[model samples]
Target: NSSDAFLLYRVNEAIRKSGAVVEFVREHIILENMVSIFGNTEKQAELINILFLPIVWGFFHIIKAFFSTPLSALSDKIGRKVTIIFGWTIYTSVYVSFALIVFLPSHIQIPVTFVLFTIYALFYAFTEGTEKALVADMVPEEKRGTAFGMYNLATGVSTLPASIIFGFLYTYFEQQFPGYGGTFAFGFGGSIALLSMILFSFLVKAKNR
Candidate 1:
């Protein structure tokens, strides 16, 4: 029961930090394109390449590495459903922000992007390993092997198609719809995340440790 909804949601967000990957890639592609077209400054590119990108990524990993264990510990203390929902909440917000950042002035986008990047990293800390922990939490010790196999299967098979569709929506739809592409892509993602969280709250009977 719990694992059923959990399985479905994991299919969509099986790769929890995927939002981060999409975020940065969009920044490099769409944001940079906008900057050049608007003629913000050539130095901006050099600055990003030389300094900003690395710091953003470095900070992300640093935060994830630092907090992942603690957050997972928290999951043990609190409950998997609650914390998993919390992580999905983080994902939805970040995706929405990434989608909406296009509306901000070019000057502020970099710093704003950096902040979102840091925040996005937290989703991983909250959900990544905890998700596996959840499979263990939900099933009998004897059944855990099958549960984990199914879990891994959901993750692996769903990832490729999900990635393809999201990228298509982010790039192709944007090209087709102009300013609305990201709104559609990321907004849709946020909606899915929100829906999943809500559904999980209702369906998952997985007892927490």
Candidate 2:
């Protein structure tokens, strides 16, 4: 999910810097092009964080607030494994949809991006606390602390390599494929997420059986 996050960030930044509503530049839409247009990386990043991220996150937090408690309660009723798997499925699907934004007409990009981000917030509501509960359910009471520490450590550690790999993939693909590199990187991340969901589902099934 962190990989997907980083790739999506790049995609959003690219879209923002490209002037989503106007056709100011005619070259391939990548980070460098954004920098070139904006005159520097810092300004471009600032504009996105200040102008774009706020609106997206504002809607996201609203959706998350509305859905979080219900999703957690649903997980308790339906079981953690099922809830987590379903969340991962939504996450993967959202990433795939994010990747496909390049295929859509330019006029709808902002609305579509906001909708996907909102869905992603809902997905987080389902998995965030539920996964920690699943960890607690799996491990013994005595070793719960250590189990959680290791679980968090693994997720945190994986983010560094995930970021590096996806960053490189984005740059490489953008050079090779022009306007489609970010999409490729996002699609790749979504594929990885989908595979993870399937493997986790199998493990959960076997454990329950």
Candidate 3:
């Protein structure tokens, strides 16, 4: 649905599949291994890794698509910077919440994940079209193509390593730290989003003022 959401979901999906190399391992990764650190039953945790995950994950996108147009329009009414900051805040919250999933039991997962997914939808709704629109608002018309090109390039460049790091977390770091891999990786991502939001605030004041 959106770039920031796109990026984070990749990390989200990768965290499970990238947990190991073998096909069976990929299918069975994440939930079980994650909960095992706290001594939960593998079978109980495996419940979350099943069909339930996709259904809820897909629902998140539907809600996002439903609200995206209206929320993007909200940017026109308020301001792109404010809307974007709001979206970034939502993204940070989502990332932080996902990271904290380790503390929850398998039974709590359904409601907890559903709530996070719902909130995650709003993140995309706030940022989707607004990101490109913000670029247009900030740059001169004559250089719009170059600006968009640069925006896409930056997003792509960052995505490569972000994927790699996320992939590594569920694979190597999970092995080393047991339950903390996702926590560290997602917490790091949330911190980056928050820092970027703060920096963007200063940029808005500088450019808009």
Candidate 4:
């Protein structure tokens, strides 16, 4: 029951982190492109940072807080498996959108980037707490401590290599493909996340059977 949930949590964390590294790289690439397009003057860069830092961050956090409880309730009603699958679907779709955004004209990229990042924050609300509850549901009262510890350990370990591998892949792709390298790298990472979701679905199904 919850065992598969725990396993999926670990796998999802690993892949999510890996994909996130690529996303980070993409952000830097985007930032650089923006600087080049808009000029490298300090005042211009400061204005750009101002637009993102407080406004985008605050907007996303507000939206996430507003939706978190509703999503948690929905998960309680529909089941953790479905909720997690939904979150992963959104997560994968966000990355896919990021990949596609690379093809759009530079003028439209900034606004689209902010929208996608906000959606990613919203999707996180769906899975963040619900998965922990799923772990608790699957374990015995006395054993939950151990179960949670192990879950944390698995996810923690997964994070270490995820960034490293993603960084290497990002560098390789950027070198090989020039403008589209970051897109390819991010798409690759997103595909890995999608594969993890598929595996998680299968694990959940097998557990249910």
Report the CA-based lDDT of candidate 1 relative to the real structure. 0.67
For model 2, the local distance difference test gives 0.75
* Residues 36-99 of candidate 1: C-alpha lDDT, one tens digit per residue: 5533454544343434445556777898899899997788888898889899899889877766
Backbone clash pairs for candidate 2 read: none
Best by lDDT: 2
Q: Let me know the TM-score candidate 4 reaches against the reference structure.
A: 0.72
- Summarize candidate 4's per-residue lDDT along 56-162 as a digit string, tens digits: 55676788898888887787778888888899888788766765665665545456656775787767789887777778777888999999999888877887677
Better of 2 and 4 by TM-score: 2
**Model 2, span 72-176: residue lDDT tens:** 778778889888889999889987887777667666777787788888887889998888888888888999999999999999999898888888887899899
Q: Global lDDT of each model?
A: 0.67, 0.75, 0.70, 0.63
Which residues of candidate 3, in runs, are more than 4 Å off? 1-48, 170-172, 205-209
